[model samples]
Target: MSSRRARFGVFGVVALLAWGAISVVRPIPERRAGEVISGVRTPAWQERVDSLQRGETVGGVLSRGGLTAQEATEAIGAAATLDPRRLPAGMRITLGGPEGAPPSRISFQLAIDRFLHLTRSDSGWVEHEEVLPWATDTLVVRGEIARTLYDAFDEGATELPPGARSELAWNVADIYEYRLDMSRDLQPGDTFRVLFERRRGPEGTVRIGRVLATNFASGTASIDAIRFESEDGRGRYYDTVGKSLRSAFLRAPLEFRRISSVFGMRRHPILGVWRAHRGTDYAATSGTPVRSVGDGVVVRAGRMSGYGNVVDVRHANGFVSRYGHLRAFAKGVRSGTRVAIGQTVGLVGMTGLATAPHLHFEVLVGGTQRDPRKALASTGGDPLPSADRPAFDRLRADYLALLQRVSTQIADSN
Candidate 1:
């Protein structure tokens, strides 16, 4: 038995030695760094993100990101659509290529919804601007006016993106400019409801789109405006009955601002005498654009006594509108020049006999100065035609229903 066991052990040792010799003669192949294992290939490129520093040029940024000076120049040349030197600080940029090698592709955000991409080709680098899509959502916002429309919007649309509330207030004021002077007509208890489009981009940025409908109530007066496109394919605000919201004359010469002085008896800031003040004074910053209230011909565009740098426009039906305290007259705004409504005629200034920067607006009937608010209130834009009444009615109903539903939801939530 002992002799048989010894023979089996010897055979086992011989077999192990033969197996080790065979392994050394024929070794298995080694895999490369980016070789395909099974079915998936290892990625050849890596991505690096960076932000543009203050006062840094595009070439400097590219060079700092492991790119040669020649490659940076080529990339800058490819970006013809944008000025590389004007890129804002903190703008995000992305580079993609093999690790430790020059980037073959680069991309950067131009705006919240715009991107610029550059890629290497056989000849040189090519570039293209990309416009990102935005998804739109209709929402209703309601607020009460404690001071001004801008304040009310800020208080009500708290979740709105920055600057959106101000934009909405301006748009709403524009819609009601014909019927209501937003600068002064709004009372403390006045309330407004707006139904507008809110657009959201892929990066979660928000912006205000079209205002579909709005309602503003002050005292016993309630005004409603609905957006409808006419046969000319232009969008205009109209009442429930389809009467356009635009008037022959805008309510104010400057955009929505405070009224420093009104018509009638008031002590002049410069003269200190209680006398007849024929026009309304709108307090605004210097250089604010002053617009023509109506379409008219420039009868006067020069300096006058106490009214520094004035522009007088003669409209239809013996009406003449005057803009005073202008820093400079707009180009081509001379005598006999025809100007359109809402056109920029001059910039606000304290050039003449004015104590501070303000726009003095006056409306003349025949040759007598009259109250501008009462004189221009009766004028209105064209009403919707009978053929388009059905479309207007349908749109009005839908938007009003949306406003009501949202208001109810808000009340319940509160």
Candidate 2:
């Protein structure tokens, strides 16, 4: 989480910007109308860059780039692998050909990792796809909690790409969901450090990739997580001793948010009578996504008396979790639908027996309601297999060593 500004080393910024493989592309100039000049036709290699407008079709983009109707249709047909309507607005397309003639080459980036090339052949047009390589670098960011993790990330990750800090915070919280509740566990003086991947694509777009290693410290308690993949082919985070960070259930059903009500005897907001509150209420805005706290099949998804719209998921451990006051169920979520941990199931709402927009979450064991916090805390994660311990140990050692090197550099810089 974030309070103190993390040290983003000057070298890291310079190294990221100095990727030798990344180069700026310039447009080719237009040539004069061809007239026999010195009996040798001067080949006019004209290039134009056009962006796809909103609600515009591929044919429209081709026509605007000087392609005839017939040529545009042929080009579209040649690139049948790409869905023309699926192309997002602001996608840049490059057209190149002789001046005053239809383009011979059409190019566009389909995604950060994919590029499409359409070229005119002797018989017809042909399409070729290219994979764009990204320049990747590992960087370190350290922050101290002030008010919340979001604040810490906003203040500390100034060197990160716009909008990336928020994503990083969410991802960090997700990695430790079973071990820590970001909304309540972190204090003002708590600290966090991360070693993460920064990738830059051909368009100079920067994004946060994988988190290689991270550590969080609150008072005398500290937790360190390192990324590792075992022979089982599943990649996950583990502690220094190789214990997994993932548990059967998440600490909470929603992302970091304020708790409006806790489980206990309380006066009913609607009935105005003292009663047992069998669930925890999380105060959140309507339309905010609510996720399943664990892997389970939905046993029920319909309106319940006083609960409004609700979903009941039955986990493998015979524990049933209930989410109530949902605005709408996510697509494909219904009775008998299997859901994975952290999968979105509904949206927060105030439909029945509620005063404001909030989620009423409950955990039931043996057909009886239990405190979600205490129930989830009783679960635990698995440890690395003895056969895979050597590989995990090697990865953890290397990652920690790299993290320490960066910490030393930060200390030296200050």
Candidate 3:
């Protein structure tokens, strides 16, 4: 019995030695650097890394990391405590195993500071908060009006979004309150441009800020720029090179005109109503320009039943003016368009039950309409600075001389 036991033991030793030799020669599989080995004997570390990168949100990251939904949630919770709800739309994550072996487990961390770590859960990317950065850039846009200002903006060439055109018109009126009245005299080929600031949001939303500059050109006359200036520490509109744009009185008080049965009310030419005449009736020549008597805003511009193509402007210091019986409107002339003393607003035509072409012009103090022709209280004069008057006079003289030369040349050609 002892000899048989010895033989069995010897056989066992031989078998163990043979196994050791085989192990020494063949060796067990080992992981390379940056590689992970799993108990399932699969090379899943690379797949997991790829999955995490493809995830748009935290939850997606965990699922791609080879974790079940619940497992990924819990793992992500433990790793970053991020809230899935607050996760950003386009975030990426990376994962890696310990060196020299397949990764048995992995973890995640956020690099962007805006991401707020939330509670962890069994589900992937359970909770998180994302904060956005503030914007500090400025944007500018310029446009021209040909034929009509509204049509130019509304045609979508300006590339502004909805409601931008109205806002732009308002800005022009606000800045050039003393220069342009868009109702009466805007010719078919008149042109204009504006400058302003734009703000953008993190979500790619955009909005316009304050208007910085504006230019309006008509015929041979042009107002180059309307800008903000500080003189004596007081800010006001100045020209392109810093000159006052204000004047004592506006060039014209009414926007556009045509002769509508003369100044007297005789049998109410069109209405047949017997009423006392209070103002002159200028005939509207369809597409004629309308000018503002003074700098003001269009408090009203539209139809008033019998008055057709009516426009009313409210000026500074309790002054108001009205224009009626027109054919069509100038570009950008609306309820809030600002006008200078001589700015053209609309064209002339016989509208609103008019018997013939003519503008019904009226000036109002407080709220009562009065005779515009008689109400001419000579206002608006040069704003030449007392200290700079001499210089301005000299410049003006030189400019006049040059203008005369050009005029003579043109006359010679004619």
User: For residues 249-272, what per-residue lDDT tens digits would candidate 1 score against the true structure?
Assistant: 888887664344333446887888
TM match of model 3 to true structure:
0.37
Give the lowest summed-lDDT range of ten residues in model 1.
Answer: 405-414
TM-score of 1: 0.80
Quantify how close model 1 is to the true structure by its C-alpha RMSD in Å: 9.4
Which parts of model 1 are misplaced by more than 4 Å? 1-57, 76-92, 121-129, 257-266, 407-414
Give per-residue lDDT, candidate 3, residue 3.
100
Local distance difference test values of all predictions, in order: 0.84, 0.84, 0.57
Candidate 3: tens digits of C-alpha lDDT, residues 346-401: 76678886777777777787787775544554333345466755544554444333
Model 2 alpha-carbon drift over 4 Å, by segment: 1-45, 53-55, 121-123, 256-279, 295-306, 311-320, 329-340, 343-345, 363-371, 407-414
| TM-score top scorer | 1
TM-score of 2: 0.75
